[model samples]
Target: MSVIAVLALDGAPGHQLTAPGLAFATAARHHHPVAYEVRVCAGPGFAGTGGPAPFGIEAPWGMEGLDDADTVLLLGHEGFRAAPPPGVVDALLAAAARGARVGAVGTGTFTLAATGLLDGRRAATSRRHTRELARLYPRIEVDPEGAAVADGAFHSAAGVLGGVDLCLHLITLDHGDPVAIETERQLFLHLHAQAQDAGGAAPEDGPGAAEAAYNAVTPPGSSLEPVTRWMEANLHHPLTLDDIAGRARLGVRSLTRRFRAETGLTPLQYLLRTRIQHAQRLLERTDDPVERIAARSGLGTPANLRHHFQRSTGTSPTTYRTAFRALVSGITWPERPEQP
Candidate 1:
């Protein structure tokens, strides 16, 4: 069993702290029996978090608790102005030096980056902090995309909500894809599970793919299949209502009408988003030149790719790819459980 130390930083997001713990705990509860032993660590004299769910909970251990962890998970928050305590950073850096997997949730990327451990490494944090994180450490690769990213010893997620996705991703990495998919089903989160499946939706948190919380909510519609497949094939091609409709074997007007009715997005809107997804994947999984990536994903040119890429994800494709390339490679991310 791996020992996980969850760094209970002051002002951490409520959900960010709880999500991974729940994931690890649930894994421990069912599949592997003794999957992980989690320790909540805080600095000396640090009072309770007091925000909400995890805030009121007392830390079971202090800085000393981190000493024995095989993996350290840092919860993030909006307190970018306040740097992580020097001692805490020292401990985490030491842990990483010891070959422990260092993971950060959301804004916690700030803390990890501040340690200089993630210099030139691909990491992610919430979209809100992308510019700030980069402005502070120009070399560290910061992905604004939502999937939790892991490169060598460092790992990071895009935001508080992303914490859950990272947890599932880690579960798949630590345990296996099946276990993670089962857990995601229990959480009622369809996106992560779909991601696990080979034919799942795009990873950009698209219209039909992203949702509120993981719940067994009815899916948006079946048009997802034809739409996603079409996007995958025609990413680099100029997509239109007629183009997609022809691919899906429906009339342009009917395809447009049905896709909008089902997904609440026009065909062009859906096509643009799907193209962005392909571009992101290409950026993360390949070393293709920017122009090549734009051509391959149907974004037209490097300029067009950068333009739409930034608009959707708040960062350049090159920057996102540099940081995330290591994550999705040969990785079959987990998927949602099939409906009964």
Candidate 2:
């Protein structure tokens, strides 16, 4: 099990700390034989946010816990508007020095950036704070809408609810795409149902926002859509830019330039992402055999599939499938849970 230490300082955003805590805890409970051991540590003299209602949280560990953790998550609070306190920066710097994977949620990047750990690194901070973050840390690339960004050993999220995205993304990192897909299906469907009942689509894709963002940059007739469709259809067959350009009736130069403009990725890179995305869907939603899945995703051999799948997600395809199947069928790990 990976050991995670969450460093909570005074005035910490309540949800920022609790979101990761609950996500890992729920994952541990549902999967059993816990995939992680989570420690919630407080900085010296930390009294939390003091709450609208009084409460007390006794810390069993302190900054020292961060030293032993495989992953250290920094929780940022209102106090982070200025530079992080000296102690907080020290603990984060030490964790990074020891080669630990580090991350932040929402404005927590402020603290991580203060340590100089994020210099020349990409990070995500809350949209409201994006300009300030950029102004403060000119060396750190702040992506406003990016779900999460991993620069070297640092991972960061852009907003409050991006916590769920961060957790699911970490699930993708720790388990595999298949596991991540199943977890996303569960969480997404629940959230979607809640949003529908609340009379609004989810904030990420509510009404015209997604389309507006898409159109604001790339108008219709851009090279991305057609090439993307072609890749999806011909993924099983060997593909080439010449063939794509011919099918799309565009010159290679036009196709390449426009494709990159629309998607921010080269045509071949987009093809690979599409293939992997398809394979991930298959792994999560189907009982198809692995060999068939490899062929269906245009990935060809099982060895190739395993190689890229593990490379992208950190776990074997079979392990991913087993975990996914268990989760979807309402079965827990180790021993299957009862199915109705």
Candidate 3:
């Protein structure tokens, strides 16, 4: 099991504790190979099993428990920006050195920041606290508006609800999209389903939310829609810029300029992302070997697939496939709950 330790300090916000706990607890119940072992580990002046918060949690472990965890998570506290207790920073550093993932919820990024793990890494905290965080930790790259960001082994979420996004991201890391999507349906569907509806026709665009975030100023319709659609449909065939330009009925320079103007990414960049997305789906849904998946996803070979997959996602293809398969055998999470 992947041991996950939630570092519970005095005054830590209760919501963050419940957020990840709810997410992984549900995953353990539903997912096979039983992934995460979540324990709330407390610090000085700590309350017993009862956690701080709206849920009235009673944590089972104390600060020492974090020493053996695979991941250490920090929750926001009243004085989160204040320096941590004597051994807290050392413990966090020790965990990071051992390749354990460290994450924080809300202003808890400030607490993690104090430990220097977030230096020169991207972190997201509540927009309300960005300036103070930036001033305090000038080396850390803070995204004030981000829903959540996982850069390398360090992860940060903006606020209370951002905690949900962070937890989902972690689930996706541990079990891929199918399990993560089911967890969403169980926990957040009724509340967020409508917000998720702001998408365009699938053939015209590949996933609207990501595109919008990458290039919010772009217009709705792309002038090169047909070419993009063709690229999406033919990802398995080895493609080059000349092929794309020919499809656009334009010279290389003209196609490049227009595509970049219409979408923030270049033609090849978009193609690469599309191919990677396809590979992710296959890894989640099929038992095919990495070599076959690479060929099907236009990555050409296992070596090539590993190169791009690790670049895009921080983990290798084999690891991703293992995590995905561990989540469920063949169960696809329902799109909506059945009416009672």
Candidate 4:
């Protein structure tokens, strides 16, 4: 069984404390053979007085709980801007030194940064804090666009949803794609049901009602949801601006203007990004040859796929696959003994 130690600092967000456990429990339920032990470790001076409400939490473990954990997660707290409390930095350093995967969620990156572990590494945090993090730690590269970042054994996430993404990512590294996908599906369904329950009454087709309903679930660019969903469904096809414009029932120029205005990308650019993301998923989950994967992802040829994959991800497709598999298997190939 793998042990995940969540370090809950004073004023820690309730979501951060519970999200990892929820994700791992869902994963364990989906994949019966893999068991996970999630322990919440209270940091110094923690009184569970923070988050959206005032509540009391009695953590089962203390800082020492991180000693033998396979993964140590630092949860965001209200006082993240301040230096970490005594022994917190040392404990994180020791955890990293012992080969445990260390992660931070949102402002928790500040605590990890206090340990200098994030120095000279690309880390992600909430966009609101990216400037502050960079201003404080000039050595660290803050990726505002990334939802989550994984550099070696150190991971960081942007916010609550990003924290969930990070947890699913860790689960993917441990159990591969199917389990992670199932876990995400379950979570999505649960959240959707909750949204419906919270909504209570059916929305009437009054002025602004449609807009409110749309904004409730979708982001700013979601006016083009149908078009984007169609684009995703047909990524295997040779789609062009004309095709997308036709689908959206707009002229090419109009479509380009609206697409860029809403989604901040041209139709072609969005399609390419979508294609690349699809290719990455195929690389992670399938053993198909590069040529087949390329065609399936609408990148046309293996050369085209390699060119874009390398450009977008800074690594070749083959190399990315090998590295990802190594991460999933938890093996460093260089240290493996040669078979007779």
Candidate 5:
């Protein structure tokens, strides 16, 4: 089993502390042989945020818990604007030097930044603090619009939901598509249950109610959830408008209209964007050649992938892979579970 050490400092948000364990535990329960041991390591002066009254958090482990961890995640603390507690930066640096993957959530980027590991890396933080982070750390590239960023072994996320995204991304990297999808489904089901318990109307009431509840937790495109899920699953195929429309059981014109209204893009435009995203993931995670990645992403050929990738991200596929891989060259990834 892999060990994930979550460093919870003073004023750590409750959601950030629990989200990683929730995601990793869900993945382990749903996917065989994908076990992860999560250790909550409390830093000096640890406390929890967000409640009627602030409370102390007694973690099971302390800073030394990071020594043998496979991954160390830092939770954003109230003291982020100030220096991290003494020895926190040194512990993070030691963990990273030992080839452990490191991640930060929300303002946790500030804590990670204190170690100097993020000096030349790209990172994401809450939109409200983007300008402040940039002004304080000019060497780091601040991505204001990115929900999560993975530069080599270091990862950082922005906003409240960004931690969930970062955890899911790590799960995907550890396992694969099947395990990640099942984990996501389970998480969504839990959210749905919570909504229902909070007196939210059930989906059986009407499409309007269902869409509203879904959009409340998920990103936009809840109106066409089924179609969007289908599109993502079949991204490897050369899908045309008729094929997509047929899957939705709608006429071509109606499908186009709904797609535009719900997602602010035409059907083909959405598909292209999805394809580009798929190519990006392949480039980031795999050593696949451009031709193979192009086929898998439905772009068909290296030339086509290059043309669209450059147009979309303003970087060539080769350059992107090189830059992303450079920092990770000497790091060793955690061992994968044996397939059953």
Candidate 6:
């Protein structure tokens, strides 16, 4: 029964505008107890969006729609860098002052930052625009590469595709893990879930977890940093639960709980997924043999890698590599004969 105002300024991105609604709508369709009442609202005579997905829209509510919203989600538009429309910042301030969760997508971060809600906090936008965002808003801590970021009640992300990751993360926060997973499944977003890698990167977008993604969302100088870094450094070696706990200097039970709370995946789950993700990058970027890729990714053997890769990606290693290479490089690579 939470009211969500999806505020679209002139020229909002299509997916960022609709991805939240689509997620909640499907949540209800699948008996997930749709908790949000979403309204697509725009100011009077709002101009249509221009980039990526261009379309005109008519909505039933105006700025007034934000008055009762439990959440105000700002969607980016063509003139995202320009100052917000008259009364928009005031309306947003009023909503935030009332304890409503304010969210932003892509350049919408600019609008949110204009309201000073995101001052001194990290906000994310398209990696392409991170430089502009940082230059324009020096007070804001901008994370240009995050797929999505959640610090307290404020959230933001880099792209329209990231809207799904952002929404699902929100759904997970609002409901529980099960409900969010079900809703994502209902929405047919299994392959793109991008939960966590202990490094904070989303596999499909942004760079890999080679950077400090997990700690980025955790408290400043998290205790988990050293262990997480050690885990990432040793993914090529067979690691055990006890080994991880020893690295963290915590008992296994405590480690499990921390993993669940921080990353929404247990340590083993995170490590396995990270390994598979690493294998994926190898398959996509390298001409290495599957055996070597498996060993390096810590999957032990080719058969083991294949089993999990199929389960996680719905495609064989070879097929995944071909498709990804073709998509990213605009050139198809036929399979090379395996090295003995």
| Predicted model with the maximum lDDT | 4
Q: Which lDDT tens digits does candidate 6 get at residues 1-340?
A: 8788989887776666778888876555433234578998995447775555478878888899999999888887667778889989999899989888888877788888898888888899766678888999999889967467876678887654537677877777776665576565435432222333343543442222122122112222456767876887799989999999998889999999987776556788778876876786688678999999999999999999998877665567886675555445542322111100
Candidate 2 lDDT by residue in tens digits, 36-100: 87898988667864343324577678888888899998776656767676687888888888899
Q: Report residue 6 deviation for candidate 2 (angstroms).
A: 1.0
In candidate 5, what are the lDDT values of residues 174-204, reduced to their tens digit? 8766557657645654554455446764333
Q: Clash totals for all models, in order?
A: 18, 0, 6, 0, 0, 6
Candidate 4 local lDDT, 1-340, one digit each (tens): 9999999888876766778888888676534445799999999999984635557799999999999999999988878888899999999999999899999988899999999998899998776778989999999999986477999999988754527878988887886665577567445434443444466722232111211000001122357878888988999999988899999999999988876666456788778867876786788799999999999999999999988776665567786676555445652212111100
TM-score of each: 0.53, 0.55, 0.54, 0.59, 0.59, 0.56
Cα error, candidate 4, residue 25 (Å): 0.4
By lDDT, rank the candidates, best first.
4, 5, 6, 3, 2, 1
State the local distance difference test value for candidate 5. 0.75
Candidate 4: count the clashes.
0
**Model 3 TM-score on a 0 to 1 scale:** 0.54
Which residues of candidate 5, in runs, are more than 4 Å off? 50-53, 200-340
Off by over 4 Å in 2: 32-34, 50-55, 187-340
Give lDDT for model 3: 0.70
Error of 6 at 283 (Å): 21
TM-score of 5: 0.59
Q: Report RMSD (Å) for each prediction in the order shown.
A: 17.3, 15.9, 16.5, 19.5, 17.7, 11.9
- Cα lDDT of all candidates, in order? 0.66, 0.67, 0.70, 0.75, 0.75, 0.71
Candidate 4 Cα misplacement greater than 4 A, ranges: 197-340
